[model samples]
Target: MGAAGDMSMRCVLLALLTAAAAQPEGPRLISANVGIIQVDCCFNDTVVDHGQVVFNLPSKCLQLVCNYGKIIPRFLGDPGRSHCCEFDGLLYAEGAELAGHCVVMQCTRKGWIPRGDIDDCCKHCSVYDDPHFVTFDGYRYDWHGYCNYSVAQTDRTYNPEAGVFSDFEPCFGGPSCLGRSTFKDHKHTVISLGHSVFNLLVNGDPYAVPLVGAEPVRCSSKVHPVLAWRNGQCTMLLGSSKLMVQHCRHRLDVWAHPTHADNLDGLCGHFNFYDADDFTSRQGDVHPLEYLPSTFPHSWRTLDQTDYRCRQCKSCPPPRVERLCRADERQLAKYTSICEKHLGSVIDRTEGLEGYLETCVFDICMMYQDRRNDREVQDWLGILQKNVNMAHMIINLRLGE
Candidate 1:
């Protein structure tokens, strides 16, 4: 009995080993007497026990786990592992496209991929305060003239759909302030601001803000081509372009789409990306920086015989010396401290910190030169400070998109 039992047991063990060797290499299954089977998963040349998690995987967004001899992938939802891209504090899902002020970005698994032509969006130009003009190319200059001037105009041969005219007048004891702006697109839109009241005119008829029209003249309160009045500011949109007029500040901002890039001729300058060629004359000649004070601005002046303001476009007073407009060291230090505290980050982002500081110094010097009482000077300075703050807010609101 002992010899036969031993031989049969040995044959059974040999047959089990042969069967295991003949099978394909895979998870090793161990059978226990309690009828439980333990399975091990093989992944990347490493063996993983069942129900064990593998944290350090190739994709940070995914985690691998061994379950029943199979490798299962699980999303970790780790903060560092994001399938979306964040822009301007907003999250864009993967494969999503976002079009902003000057750029178009697409969200990918890795990050945000910029797509399409970035120059497709509109560019900004503005005139504010004592008539400081920032051209579409970011050139800053001042032109003082009491006349109706062309702010922007499209060469009829080019687009024939866009034009902007501004009326300059003496106001707030300053040399010039933009009192009225006439925007000529498919429909004639006029914005007149006087005594803190803004009036809108469409084709010689009085129209209110948020007016809606058909095809060429579309203005709404919600969508594009919006004409809305809010917070003492009137915003007018005309075919992918926008114009904003701020009451009591004499500020006007123009956002022109890329459609009018090289086809524009006026005080707003050519919409080309280069600031050096911004001072192109109405006669179609690019002027140098030296002409910014006189030749360039005077070139865009309208000589309309029927308009009284156009007749007064005589030679402007001699260009004021900027050096003389610099404030004293003590006053400059104080103003600089204030500006650094209030507008440092904003101006730096806008690439206008140095320019704004210089403007502040000039304003201080001019205020002192006027020989106003201390209280009046402080009041004027306060107004300037408010304007700077407003500019900061407006930039963030408009460009944060």
Candidate 2:
């Protein structure tokens, strides 16, 4: 009984060892002592001893345990359950709709699904050549005032703390060019564009551009403020807002987040996506078309009119002069062709195209006053073309194209 039992037990042990070796490359029985068997788990070429827990599994969502002669797998949580997306410290469940920053997105198991149509998510407004203003609602008008004006002011009702205030200083080149511009957001992030294109200030401190390498310069501790210079243009990003100051031309292009829609006031209009009532004043009174040049712009002037830089026009060109300017078929055709060349595609989707053309004609007339030569007119036209290009770029960027 002793010899036969010993030989048969040795043979059984050999068979068990062979089976363990033949097992797929995972946890397997390494040894046997009396009635006990030693198990080990293999993960990423590392061996885990029996009764030991493996915390660092290939997938962080799972863990492994080496049991007696077997490996047990466990999940950190319910693997089938969908996770929520956290934004601005708020959690949104799957399929939840989120609207903010001028965008509407749906939360999904994988990630966010942005709205296909960008217009439904963002809004744009610009002030360009000779300081022609275009409201967010697409109302176009000319205000030849030289005072510090509020380009936009956030509606306090929607967000008592959030505000965006800007001012334009008169430049000497043309009838009125935006010489210096200042923009301030709710977070106290200030961006100023000086008379010189290279001069940029953030929070009253000069910010160097083309930073070190290919990376953009970012400032501010709480909010995300980015400044980058590319292709002779300077683009600034503050929170969800973006502003592009065109080089040389001093054209100011602003794109506000979708959340700011209907919450903006001042020269930029109500931003409610309606052009009819864009002529609203600072006191929240909507003005008629006849009030644009005088009553409308004067109502939105900054409270402090003490700035020495502020210079009002002595007097506007007489209505007869403006009419003659518009009646010039030769000059009108020239300006119209330039506007069509740069903003042709953009005009199809946006408003204020006709307004831009009229503004061009008026500015050129003001520039010369008497008889203007071809050279002076051509130079002014070049500036207008650059501004139009900047406007086109801003529109494309807002559309996410």
Best by TM-score: 2
All predictions: root-mean-square deviation over Cα? 22.6, 17.1
Deviation (Å) of 139 in candidate 2 = 1.3
Mind sharing the TM-score for model 1? 0.56
Number of clashes in every candidate structure? 0, 3
Q: Estimate each model's TM-score.
A: 0.56, 0.56
For model 2, what is the error of residue 298's alpha carbon versus the real structure, in angstroms, after optimal superposition?
A: 1.4
Candidate 2 lDDT over 1-401, as tens digits, reads 36765575456445534544454455556444565556576543467678665432211233345566455554444432233443332345666765544435565554444433334445667777657777777767766556566677675232223333445544333344565666654455666666556556777667655422111233542212332343345444333243322334456666666666677777777778787778777667887754245666666666434465443442333222123243377866766675566446655565535565566666666555545776877777767766655565555543222
76-190: candidate 1 lDDT, tens digit per residue: 4532343654433234556777553343446666444434442435677777666778888888877766677778877622223557777787743445667767666434344
As a whole number from 0 to 100, the lDDT of residue 323 in candidate 1 is 38
Off by over 4 Å in 2: 1-119, 156-174, 211-232, 240-248, 304-306, 309-354, 370-373, 397-401
- The residue-level lDDT of candidate 1 at 22 comes to 46
